[model samples]
Target: MSKLKNIFVFFGPPGSGKGTLAWLCVKRLGFVQLSTGSLFRRHINEQTDIGKQIDFTIRSGKLVEDSVVSKIVTEWLENAAHEHSSIILDGYPRTKNQAETLSQFLSEKFSSVKVCIVRLQISDEKLVERLGKRVVCAEKSCQKVYSLIENSSHKPKQTGTCDICVGKLIQRKDDAPEAVKKRLAVYHSHENELIDFYGENGVTIEDFNAADLVERIFEKFLCRFGFSIR
Candidate 1:
């Protein structure tokens, strides 16, 4: 069996471009991205009982219950750890308790793997602007995210249409400006505590300023890790 190399934990609030950064790694570095948001979206799209619950919580700008989040993440990690050599974890461990739980689980199941915690730092003002302009494909299977901001590289070829699947684009309920502010508030409350927990556990947290272009961020990421696609 192939051993997992690095499990990248991407830390950032909503609209910080974590998904875009994850996509760049997937495209250029052949890493598998396990996005909790995408997983929740799948459940929500299916309208499962849990999906309904998650949908309600998300629409109200609240975090899903920790028990629900942990169960979903644990199941994902069980399969992904065995199948993928490298993985990027997007939006999983949001709070210090979740981080502690994840740390214990990884030690027990995949102790050999390296955990790389990267925190994307950006201003709340920038995040609000970004979220306000963000749109996603309406099709659940092709929920490609796009930015309507004039200077953003994630824009689709045609307005209001997905480039890959031609699905209609719409802003997510959680992406509303007011909802974004609420999400950011919740994030800031636990952000420092989560960082401190990792530090106390002897883990290094890599911080990156996310105001730069995606391409530039990708370049800096590679240089920091000295990673090569080839």
Candidate 2:
């Protein structure tokens, strides 16, 4: 049998640029990105039964059931699209139970699974500011990321418009100040659970600043992957 490969698990706040980093992992490093949020959104767009259930849970502002989520992800893993790909899991295994589910699944299916968890550390104050000022392209097909914060490279030349498609930039509902606070609260409540779980299970867990530029973080994480990849 082929040797098992290391899987990546990303932990961070919503606006901490985890998605951007995941994209870099896929584009530059040949890792397939698996984002549960995007998975839910895509299913909802397709109007499948699982998608509608997820849509209802999201509309009610509650986390999806752990078993359901794990099953959905497992199904995705077994799909032909990512059958032979290295995976970078974004926004998954939120609770201890969920993490356990993943562990059990890996053991049963792959014999052994190695994981490295990268936690993007950002202060609550910075998270609030970044999320609140965030805007994305209104065109679904060309949804590009942009920020009003001056430090961002994606900052538009004209402001409030996507540079690529000339589409209006829309702030996501979850980017509202109150919504951001709620998300931070949820993260804090369960953050230690995942951290402790990984540590006890002998998985490598590293924390890096989410406030850094994506390019800088990308460069740093590439080094982290160096020792593991080959």
Candidate 3:
């Protein structure tokens, strides 16, 4: 209930269910979820000025310049601060430099931003299987996700459109085996260093099994962050 805003960074390898849990936390805790991947994709799909720039950046296999990424995120944060007390950032700060920039930005914006880092821990084998079978909606507003292998409980309806936005579901270009391996290589190169940076900054890093039951994951999140359902 503190007026001080909270910022949570969800950390995990691909197929760790970080997005799923992040969405749950956002709904239950009223936190705005900011995802770098989703943001970039949104822009690209919209073909906005910024999105066009990002498309070029991605095609070259180069990181989006920090200035561009920071500008977009800062604008969103400034707007959210006026209406919400906290925000959840997923799939961001993949590098130490980005993490440092975010830390400085928050320190300047809020009196004391409570930063929490949650690392979803799952076996590599499991992650590979899960991500390989994952399906993502192509639509921006209706980016409903489905797992063809592990998500037996939530089956995709016969309709090719997402239930939420009627957007067509499609396999991401990077979801293929070779692409996934390349991404994993890139992630491993910097993820540990980024994790260390946050830990050194006093960000709480909690490990949880993302492959567990939904209720169990929810309980773990609440227990670690000391939030309760209304």
The numbered model that scores best in lDDT is 1
Model 2 per-residue lDDT tens digits across residues 103-172? 8888778655567898999999999998888898999999987889876677888788889989999999
Runs in model 1 deviating more than 4 A are 37-64, 132-150, 153-178
Better of 1 and 2 by lDDT: 1
lDDT of all predictions: 0.86, 0.83, 0.78
The candidate that wins on TM-score is 2
User: Rank order by TM-score, top first?
Assistant: 2, 3, 1
lDDT of 1 by residue, 1-230 (tens): 64577988888877676778999999988889887888889899999888899999999999799878887788788887767888998766877778888999889888888888888999999999888899999999999989899967788899999999999999998989889899999898878788888888888788888888767788889999888767
**Clash totals, every prediction:** 0, 0, 0
Better of 1 and 3 by TM-score: 3
Say which prediction, candidate 2 or candidate 3, comes out ahead on TM-score. Answer: 2
Q: Estimate each model's TM-score.
A: 0.73, 0.78, 0.75
lDDT for model 1: 0.86
- Model 1 residue 203 CA deviation in Å: 1.3
At residue 92, candidate 1 shows an lDDT of: 69
Candidate 3, position 224, lDDT: 74
* Ranked candidates, highest lDDT first: 1, 2, 3
Candidate 3 regions with alpha-carbon error over 4 angstroms: 1-4, 37-62, 133-151, 155-178
